[model samples]
Target: MPTQNPRVNVVLDNFLYQNVRLLAEKDNVSLSAKVRDLLKEALEIQEDIALSAFAEKREKSWNDSETLTHDDVWS
Candidate 1:
């Protein structure tokens, strides 16, 4: 079954449109799908960075020792 594609009209500069078209060809995806994929990827990357920052905050609360104790040094 063929799925219906949504219709959207976006205006871009000629150069930008050409670049998008080239990327679409290289990736073997329709321009619309490529744009949607790119947006999703960007959002996911942003979310990952935010989660990593939150993890760093949690890690700092647990581990504060920069210098090793005698036990640690011996072990």
Candidate 2:
């Protein structure tokens, strides 16, 4: 933990903790740093899923993209 950032207490199942510890060792990073990095990535994936769902919901609303011409909007 960095002195600049406040720390929070966390509990994990022993098996889960062991696996995370192994990953930390493998990555040559402190367990806390590894956990923070993993959490950041998980958050990013969640945001991606949400954005993708919104895009998919709107994708078919467009009639034609490839063959679209300027007059499609004005005429």
Give each model's whole-structure lDDT: 0.88, 0.91
Candidate maximizing lDDT = 2
Q: Give candidate 2 regions above 4 Å deviation.
A: 65-75
Clashes of 2: 0
| lDDT over C-alpha atoms for residue 43 of model 1 | 100
Candidate 1 residue lDDT tens string, 6-73: 66688989998898889999999999988788778999999999999999998878755676788998
For residues 1-75, what per-residue lDDT tens digits would candidate 2 score against the true structure?
A: 458887878999999999999999999999999999999999999999999999998886755646667798679
| Candidate 1 whole-model C-alpha lDDT, 0 to 1 | 0.88
Clashes of each: 0, 0
Candidate 1 — which residues are off by over 4 angstroms?
1-15, 63-75
